[model samples]
Target: MTMLPIQTTATAPVATPVATSTGDPALPLELLELELSLDGFSGDEASFAEAVRQAADQVGGDFLFDLPASGLAEDCLRIAALRVPKGENGAPTIVFALLDAEGATIRVENPDETTKDLKRFADAFVDVLQRI
Candidate 1:
């Protein structure tokens, strides 16, 4: 199995503007989380990385970096990218870069997939965000 790098920095975290959702406490962040599942590939790591780059571009974010796992379970992969706009409180977040080798599945831990199949993951992510 191949491994990708994980990148996390200690830059000053920004606080986003408060946005109301369902009359609850306004989410003070302009964050958009998206997850996408891809199948029917040969499981090429390079291709996967490229796909990630493309996704980041589509979301107008830069390829901040990725982190690879260690030990016997090296097949599990995670990557993260970011997009920050001037005067914005927090950086745009894209995460949970998960790739499942056996299932040939690439799961993005974002919360913006509006498709029926991925609604569950999106909802779960939003729930976590609310609690944070």
Candidate 2:
């Protein structure tokens, strides 16, 4: 099946970290999230998320897998893509946490709210997909 590319404007996605506290002794989880609406896609959120997971896997050199967490909206799906460097060269970085919701909208999130990391992920994922 042929799939069209996701269009993005020259604007930047929100990279602010929203804090989620689990009330545990450990530090809170800070997440950077961005949402994209897929107006052209006719499939449901699950299908879109699965397609994204497959696409990320096809790129190779990365770990793309599902992340089943509680408290998300029932109509949403979440996954994670982690960049695993070759050998012991560099530490692994979580590329993004992909969350697809109803109305053909997909959200890309980074646990760490660093602007640089989010920019790298957007450049790698969004730019490449836009060129497709």
> Cα lDDT of all candidates, in order?
0.40, 0.40
Candidate 1 wrongly placed segments (more than 4 Å):
1-33, 37-43, 71-75, 78-91, 110-132
- C-alpha lDDT of residue 72 in model 2: 36
- Give the TM-scores of the predictions, in the order they appear: 0.39, 0.36
Tens-digit per-residue lDDT, 40-71, candidate 2: 23455457655545444543335444454233
Per-residue lDDT over 25-126 for candidate 1, one digit per residue giving the tens place of the 0 to 100 score = 422222232232132233545566666556556555554554453321235554333332212644444343445544244544332332223334434555
Q: What number of backbone clashes does candidate 1 have, counting pairs of residues 3 or more apart or in separate chains?
A: 11
Task: Supply candidate 1's per-residue lDDT for 72.
Answer: 15
Best by TM-score: 1
